[model samples]
Target: MESEQFRRSWPFTGVVLWMCLALPASAVAQDEGARLSALELLIRSPQLGGSDIPRDLPGPPGGVEVPLRADASTSSGAAMAGAQAVSATTLPDAPVRPSSGDASTPGLSEEMSPGGPEGSSALLSEAPRTGVSDGAPLTLLPESSPSRSFQVLPAVVAVVPGLLFHGLAPAIAGDGQTARRLFAMEGAGLGLIALGGVPIALTGASRRTIAPLYAVTLAGFSVFGISALANLYSVVSPTFDPGVPAATLPPLELEMGYQYVSDTSFDYDHFVSLGAVARLDSLKLEAVARLAPEDGNAQVRFGGAYRLLGAPEQRRGDTDGSSLDAELFGLYHRYPTEGFIVIGGDLGLRGRFAMSRVSPALAGSFAEASIGMSLQGYSYPGPVSDGNLHEQLLYSFGYGVWLGRGGPFKGEAMIFYDHRKDGFAGGLRTFGGGVVGNFGLRGRALLTETWGVAAEVAAGGALVGRLSLIYALGGES
Candidate 1:
């Protein structure tokens, strides 16, 4: 029984020894397989193996540290060492992994890091850091090519034949929409002039209907001028970005200035000028006063306008700077040396058109016009003469440019013509002083939200210049 028991115990001990020896060998093989799998996964990873992928390697302690060298000899040495290390761990018949020859293959170097050397391999140099954690491909914007007509033809045509035809430039430039609008505008203007002019002629320039008819005719002329400018602008617009209108303006403004007038027909030489403007929702009111202390000559004029179309002065928004208004004004003048006091009233229509609507190149430029009639009577201090009521045709037109981009320093400068002969800067004395009006250049700028400056130089029968200080209140800053 003792022999049998010993034999059984010996077999059991042999079995335990065999299991202890085989278990460690099996675990070693599994670990090697897992390591190979991990290496394979890393080499095939999208982040590491792509054509545009960066060649940076994670360093030491927790990662497989591999060094890459620029020189062929150093690279060969590193490869040999890596191969040896793999061979020492694997079985004799184990397959060796092949190395890739692709330029995008990951390599270990300072050039691969985010703070890498500026001078790196051509492939690495092409990659740009896209504000990401690491490398990204560089992207460049495409350039645009301008067409022949876009660059040259339109502008030329607009100048050569556009002045008279109004729509010729845009039509030839293949802009049917703009051309159609321009043609329509021209036709409308001609029609209005005919409508008003025909009646005035048939009625023998009758005073009973001259006021309204004159106003209509002036409106027509204004429309024609606007359309002509627009035609030129439309063809030239491709070269520039358009300007935007002011979204808002000051509600109230006050002005004071000094005026010097050199007129052979008038005795007043120096005067004090005062003016004020008030803007409501859709209405604008203005007042002007000029006093000559040395000559005892004084003039006061007050007026208001009601908006019939487009945005108000205080809240224009994104409008094209186009507007139409009906205006009424009253005037008083005392010519102390001439011994006459003139009192008058006026009624008219005023309109403005933004040049940008016609073309981007003309942005910040505009056209303005007003037509009306003034009725006045002269009162003499001494009874020596005729006291008959006089009628004067009033018309004005201007071309202006906006000053300064949108900011506190916003304003406009204009070269204008005024056809009234009763004011301090009256019509030219040439040809009986009634045929030609005064031409002037005026500009106003707001230096800050509340303070500004204005200047005007005018010529006619007299040379007149005025400089004013402007103070603004309320509304938008």
Candidate 2:
């Protein structure tokens, strides 16, 4: 009789246990739904005006819930009722997750920018909200975005339309300051060109004012070109850290080399070249000698330059590789085959300008210009009628970049133009007596504390190439 009663009670016990488990779950679902509905209604209230809040709020970890503050400005009856209903309950918090869409999409990035709804949602989801006055409105502080690592489109623009516009690259890179400066610089360059070029056109390039006007025009071109390059550099510099100028140079350096000269007018084709440089407090001394073995031709030059507005060459850390100096050089040449000797002295002012002053991207580069005159006289071995003195214009300009950022390797490379109608290279042989000067590329580097190499190639009426070994007395190791 006992076994029969126990069997009969088993089915009722199971049914009761099922009801006990199901009732709480059903009640919990209803309460969660009510909380979500209340929150959604509050978000859609007239004062809040946020109807896009998702209906299915994600559940919080550890079962903790967060409550949303209702706007204190709710005046309407429906809005007030919604606000009250939301304040009376709590909503479960959810871990914030980034959007599942492709991050590289342009539209998506724009929509997720700091001013967008997603940015606010991200902040709200990540930050715990508590201890806020109900009357105060929620205000989000702007979040700073990380700088771009590299940009290809802006770099391309920098080469194309940027060549003409000068600011397109930086503008595209979101560098408004750099863009504005470049635009201003471009405008100034155009203005200068107009200033000088218009006058020259009006005056037919008269000899009276041609020199000054020509200078102004060249200045304009320099400015315009520099600004254009700066635009490109600004967009591209994020890819790498820019190099800095060197602080010092070797105090004493000596060089010896072989030079090959190809000139139709001279019989000598091979020669030996030797040079020396000494740096002092504010004075620099230099000496050079060249000898032709086959024809007994010899040339020697000795000169010194004084720093007028810059740190000495030995210690140039004070400035950014920019300086102005006064130069004085004397030269002597003997030609056995040509039966002539030439003696001359050159006086000039040379200046270097750091490109970084124009734009931060142009660091480690500089532009140089020099102008002066040379007074020379030719002497013949035998009695010759012509004994008149000659005066030649001395001018040169070059664009140079510093080599090596650190360690023992240090030097500079330059592409340059020389205007003086002297030296082995001389001016270009033309129908008009070689008005254009020589163009060359030259570079020197110190491999160790006391050893280095220098190389040069120049072209004009003659093609000249030289490679030299350098020895230094003292410098940074």
Candidate 3:
């Protein structure tokens, strides 16, 4: 009877031991699950002001801790209570026997411990220690808040006296970086004006230095104008996007158009023109022909250009960064009434620079310059007419903007000076028949990917206008 009683007591002892081992594992699993669920709820809650959470919250002693705003503390407290209740239900009915002080009390609510649910609730009620712990709530100003009232004043100032004071608007607005750049640009412009103006004045505006001086003076004015515009733009629209989609020129293009000349000397008023272009890697070939049907006059030009510097052909896009090119061209002209023919060949250089990096308002801005020398032979109906070759210089410089990259509408506008004294303008003479230069405006706008229109107006020796339709055969859409 003694051996049987010992055996029965052994089974009861084994059962108690098993309960002690299982309780802690069950409690750990419950705690982990509760923590994960609470975290998920908190993250999905819209009351936390989107996803901008504080990064410096302190971790709890044995688990993760999330700092809660004052409005969220009540709901979080309820969640902690539910987690404690669930942990309690998982405990075994028989009390877990503690071995030394190492064993945790089974079925004792976590909320009742020193670092318990109440302690966490108290911590949550206080603002996060990162920055808002001073008892004041965190508040963000609205986008159109009254504190930004001073912005409009800068815009007004930028428009009035700001034209002369390039950086004043940005300086007043506390943008030192932009202000410095604008002031530097204005200084450079002033320096250029002085450099060009003083010499011209000292020399009494001699004809020999007039052209170069005029160019430098004009460049200074352009710089001033651009800087003034930039100042106004910076204050009025501080956050404008200057990005244009990358675009590339096509391999082939075709164009046809009509031109109207308003020359007092020429009887021919209308002409039809055809043009074609073939582009290869770093090389371009082009041909153009114009005919005056009533006057029986015609002109034809052929040319090829090779890129010497800048990005390669494969890298060219709508925003062609910068490029320098050399070209060789030949032209043939037939005059009806004058009964003369002219043939010429020219060698030239062309360069373009993009200015998008300077300012958003001038995103598509570009400057171009071309210079060349042409050798020509003239023939007339009379035997005394000489066929000797004559040399002529050709040069032009312009500034413009490229518009509508990665869009249906695409175009360019430019104001330029042309030094050629030919065509209807050649017959007229001023100040002892000296050649007069031309000032011109040219623009081309495409309505869609395949078709577009162009117009040009020039005034100087003679006034001229041209209109045309353009089609792209193969290129960027």
The models' CA-based lDDT, in order, is 0.69, 0.71, 0.63
Clash number for candidate 3: 3
| lDDT by residue for model 2 (1-477), tens | 245558999999888676655444322122133324343444444347542222223223321232332322333443344434333344344332333333322111223335554553453445444445634332222233455567899999999989999988888888786788889988998888899899999998898897777767756765686677677767877877655556788999999999999998886799999999999989999999999999999999999999998788788774677889999999999998877889999998999887777666567777787887789988975655545478766777776778868667778887777876677887886785526678899999888888999999999878999999999998875
- RMSD (CA, Å), candidate 2 to true, equals 22.7
Candidate 1 lDDT score at position 265? 79
Pairs clashing in candidate 3? 247-317, 247-318, 250-475
Against the hidden reference, what TM-scores do the models get? 0.61, 0.61, 0.57
Worst lDDT 10-window in candidate 3? 98-107
**Per-residue lDDT of candidate 1, residues 144-191 (tens digit):** 334423547767777777777778888887778677778888899999
- Per-residue lDDT tens digits for candidate 3, residues 1-477, read 244458889989888666555433223112233323333434433344222112122323222323233443334353343333333222224322211221122112334333644444454453234466533332221123222223777888897789889988978887776678888878887888888888999998798897677657655655665567667666755444333423565577688998877777788878897888888888899998888999988999999999998754435664355789999999999997878898999898988766545543345566677777789988876565444668766767776666556665767777776667775334334686555467778987667767878888887767778888889776554
